[model samples]
Target chain A: MKTLDCLGRRCPVPVIELAKALPNLEVGDLIEVLSDDPASANDIPAWCRMRGQGFEGGSAPSYLVRRLS
Target chain B: MSYGQSVPPTTNLDSASGLPLHPAAREALLTAVDEGWADPSRLYASARRARQLLDGSRAAVASVLGARPEEITFTSSGTSALYEGVRGLASARARVGRHVVHSAVEHSAVLHAVASLDTSVVGVQRSGAVVASEFAAAVREDTAFGCLLAASHEVGTLQPVADVAERVGSVPLLVDACQLVGRAAVPAGWSVLAASARKWGGPTGVGVLAVRTGVRFAPGWPEDEHQHGRWPGPPPLPLLLASAVALEAAVMESAQEDVRLRGLVDRIRAAVATIPDVEVVGDPVSRLPHLVTFSCLYVDGESLVRALDAEGFEVSSGSSCTSSSLEPSHVLVAMGVLSHGNIRVSLSRTTTADDVDRFLGVLPGIVADLRAQAGV
Candidate 1:
């Protein structure tokens, strides 16, 4: 699992980092984002859904994702 | 129709933010400002005249809403009415149950008003309308109060207020009709309801709250003789009268305007979808006729709004970046939709077909430009 630290960040920044980080990992690799920003909780999952990546759930400040394509 | 301004902006598509006072309201206010200046509570001759205007105002607003004049209480604003509606019902039913139930997409006013109570927020579909079964399941026999919006202020989706009300049994419901009063008929089966005058091209300082005759309510504010102890002090009689006049005119023209605005909105929805990576949201079929919302991938709302303003169009946005709070709109999040790069364009009686056509032409370029700048 790879962890992207987005703590102390505001909206768009955290999701932007997540989008940027997802492309570098292997197809099956798992990634988690550490974001205190409230919008990230929903935006990250929505991004995965929109981009065809896998969303393995995690709570606020710790959203887990999987690289798929 | 003029505010005595020298230069009017090119076009305004943000009527939902608050319509500038209606021409009718403006005309009424010009005369009422002097005639309504006296205290309606006093016994003087001028005071009696003010009292007559205030009474007539309530009766006029109530007639348009299908409510009785005495049932209406003019609150300081729509938010205050929600507080009075929710808390008063719960306060009156203190022994019944502490449980309050509402749709998750309710306005922050309802959410804030119910913060102190035990509450259940029922989830909604992607289109932002609540499933009646799910909503009914959340209501308990002991539930003190329930709330639902007549239509979404953000997405303009209409809720199943009537169906949910039918299944909730005897629990008193507070229908927040702020977005529906003048746009369409407020679905029946509410024990109490609240609406904003500003949404219908009325003056800012007025909100109408109507309680059905049988519904029990304790005054949420410090008990006062004014407004049936529901609100404090005498309301701004002139503006309140103007708000009533605005609502009467709005409701009268709503049916014809409904078709006209919906045609323009459909054009916007179809036009917006052609843009790359854009998502037009809200219920396509079941929504307010004049409003449409959409989100552009990777484009921040403020940038999109600023760019549109530069192009001489004005609209509203719910994306996180536009707000000082830095939180995405709860309505969008609740619908599990994109929260960034959002715009809400709501038309009005003054918005012409030419205005919408001009907007549709510029919008795609605006989104594309913002997205390209972000390298998305």
Candidate 2:
């Protein structure tokens, strides 16, 4: 599992960071992202849906995503 | 009639910044420029005539604002008036305490003034209106002053000033009326009020500040004996007179224009909501009659504003994420609304139905095109 810390950063920043981190991981690898931006609560999931990836919901302020491709 | 049937009017609708200069105010200003050159403080004949005009202008402004002439003073601009009012009140009541309480969505002028003092910011509701209870709770015994806008300039949500005033008890409340004055009846129960002349059809460079009787207010700086020593130096007699005339005319036209604008704003609010991934912010029913704000997902606000301007429609965007400003709009962030692709439409007295219809007709296609290009 790869962990990306995006706490205290707002939208587009966190999503952008997540995008940058995902390319480093192989298929079936999971990335755990931590962000406090309120928009990320919806943005992460929306981004996953748009990119056709797996979004495994996590606790508040933390998101879990799986590399499906 | 559908929008395509008739050509849209040529008038642009970006009145929140300032309205077009009224003809009456223009004439008044030209006349005063010729006659109001003398120093009102001097005892000469021309000076005395200038003094009369200045005093009469103050009285006219006071009459419309429901304040006494003794309590009103003109400043260089609305931001200056706000600084004077906030700093003066805070300093006057310093012994009470240096703490100031204000809503999170106040104008930048008020926010900057509060930043110098120990400040408590009450959160606002999603509707963009301040939560009265939260605001009341933030007002402490040590609070020297409290500030609330009569209306939100960005989103046009009306604040509960009267209720917050009652809740704060004796704590003086400074109401920024830049958007409220000349558009709606001035709400009572504020200790001080400040407004900009250009927000109505008056020329810029005139800001009015009124301190209610019995409020403890000390000038922020040393000043001459003009404006009860609150504002220093000689006043702008011609601009003051023109501002008074413009305010009165706007007030007289407000009642009828309110009905017309409200209908148009309602049309906008309803139509804007129908667009994909767009959120119409602000109180749907309790907002100002002529202003509406909506934010689109997956689009940059500045780009959208530029695209609309290219279509011959003028509008303002509040998203601080614009290229010029990296920080998102504090008002939207406070309200937990999307801070991207935001557009604030403020209708002036001259905005026509054709303008609104044309904007509505063109907006959907623009948004669709932008979203497609962005691959959202």
Candidate 3:
């Protein structure tokens, strides 16, 4: 599992960073995004849904996403 | 005379702010300034004459708004009218509740007025419109005031004001009709309404607030009894008369201009959709006839606006990341649309088909260049 620290970053930046980092990881690999942006709570899941990735729900400030394709 | 036929097109196209003074409105302003230069509140001969002119202007404004003369009060600007209207309505209904419910897409004036209150923000649909059911659900028994725009200034999506008013029965619905008043008929059943003069090609420094008869409202502060206690200061007589004249003219021209601008907007919508990675936001059919908004993926919004401006097409953008203000447009965010690279094109009565064609001709290349520079 790779942890992408996005603390203190705003929307589109955190999401865009996550998208760029996702290609580096192989399928079935897990990534956890640590973000303080309140928008990330909704945006991360929305991005995952749009991109056909697995969004495992997270505790506050940390969203765990898995590469599916 | 029609604005399109009488006024020649300018070299630079301005579709950003609807502040251009109409020719008839300008003439009215000049006439009023010469004739109405007295305090109408006094009882002297000149004051009596000014009072008559003021009353006549008020009646003219009231006639176009479907409001009574006593119900309409002119204010300094549209924002001030909204501030006074929202605060007054909230204060009057304090016995019932202190909570205010408004859609996330409401104009800044409404949002700022409700900021200090216990606000319950209703979300909007992806089309930049508030879902009537969702808005109704957000209204609690404690909701003292309800606010909904007649139409969005940014995306031009018309809200279901009548439906929401019906659902939130008994709550005072303060409809900010700034964008819709002169463009279309103000829908019935709103308890309070506000509009700006400059939005309808009238002069600046004048706004109108109409509180329906029987709606309980309290002024925000203690002041001399002017404007039925809604606005305290002496009103601008000339500007008030000009506002009435402009509104009457704009309302008369709106129906014909609506059809023409709808065709121009349809052209922009169809042409923009053909561009790769462009998402046109707002309801296609149930939207303002002269406005359209679209977002380009991976392109900076400010860059796009500037590039369009450089090509003689003035437009406005609402992207969060493109400017100093990092907060995204609450309307776009609530709608879950792309928040970056967003551009809003709002047409006025003077906008011509050639102006729109010029904009459309240069838009695709502008977006492609921006995207290419961004390496997206």
Off by over 4 Å in 3: A1-69, B1-16, B223-225, B322-324
Model 2: residues >4 Å from true position, as ranges?
Answer: A1-69, B1-11
lDDT tens string, model 1, B123-232?
98989999998988998878998899999999999999888889987888899999888899879888899999999989988888899888988876676667867888
TM-score of chain A of each: 0.94, 0.94, 0.95
Better model by TM-score, 1 or 2? 1
lDDT per residue for candidate 2 within B43-139, as digits (tens), equals 8999998998899889988887789999899998889999999988988999999999999999999998888799999988889888888898997
What are the clashing pairs of model 2?
A: none
Write the residue-wise lDDT of candidate 3 on B119-181 in tens digits.
Answer: 988888888788888888888888898999998988888999999899888888999988887
Candidate 3 docking classification:
incorrect
Q: Per-candidate RMSD vs. true structure?
A: 3.3, 5.8, 5.0
Candidate 2 docking DockQ: 0.13
Q: Model 1 in CAPRI terms: which quality?
A: medium
Candidate 2 achieves a global lDDT of 0.86
Cα lDDT over the full model 1: 0.88
TM-score of candidate 2 to 2 decimals: 0.86
Per residue, candidate 3 scores C-alpha lDDT tens digits across A1-69 of 899998987665666678778999999999999988655665677567657788998954899999999
